[model samples]
Target: MGVFLAIPVSTESFGQKSFTIDFEEGNSFTVDFETSFSEGGECCGPYTIVERFNIDNYSYELIEPSFLPIFSTVYISNPD
Candidate 1:
């Protein structure tokens, strides 16, 4: 069985934003987020773990924004 987690992001900083989902199990995912001008453009992701693994408490930060996944096939398009 896989575990799912919810990761929250602050959309107030940017009108339309996305986030890279990382796991301690050597896996990762990405989700594209959008919102109307009235809605404020905030989004959250429901992350799931495919394989069972003991994930220790970890921390992460959003270093930069890119159209590519850095080193992966995951791509998100943000249309303002």
Candidate 2:
């Protein structure tokens, strides 16, 4: 299953980026994900991507626990 999230845009900071999502029910919160690049083993590809939410301490308060995988801790391997 694919999860569709609605967020307008992101604001850049010194070492991080954050974006706010306003719900139709008049509830909204900001979600943040910090990106970094590093080398990894070939078995896991050449790099890794880890996605973390709630950097603003709001995502966990608004989103359900089970539906946070896509926005939470994720590992990615890309060969380009």
Candidate 3:
């Protein structure tokens, strides 16, 4: 004999930004972010400032698997 189970899943949104990332079981990846903004008076000149950063060699280890998996440890290298 076989048995079956049913579960309900729901998601809610409230005008917010969300992000999702996926990685292999035992792999590493790098991520970079760059942003710029300007500050000055509207009538005058607007000075612009830019900044950039990077995340290097990031990896996650899965310890257990369930509704949400637990990570054994998360590894992140130096940033530049």
- The lDDT leader among the candidates is 2
True lDDT of residue 16, candidate 2: 51
The lDDT-based order of candidates, best leading, equals 2, 1, 3
Q: What does candidate 2's lDDT look like per residue over 1-80, in tens digits?
A: 33466543222222354777565666555566554444556775433233444544232433333221233422222223
lDDT accuracy of residue 37 in candidate 1: 23
Candidate 2 lDDT: 0.42
Residue-level lDDT of model 1, residues 1-80, one tens digit each, is 33444555453443444556675665565554443223222473422211111122332232223321122232333333
Residue pairs with clashing backbones, model 3: none
Ordered by TM-score, highest first, the candidates read 2, 1, 3
Q: Native-vs-model 1 lDDT? A: 0.36
Residue 15 in model 1: lDDT = 41
Q: Which has the higher TM-score value, candidate number 2 or candidate number 3?
A: 2
Q: Which pairs of residues have clashing backbones in candidate 2?
A: none
Index of the highest-TM-score prediction: 2
Alpha carbon RMSD to native, model 1? 15.6
Question: Runs in model 1 with CA error above 4 Å?
Answer: 11-14, 39-80
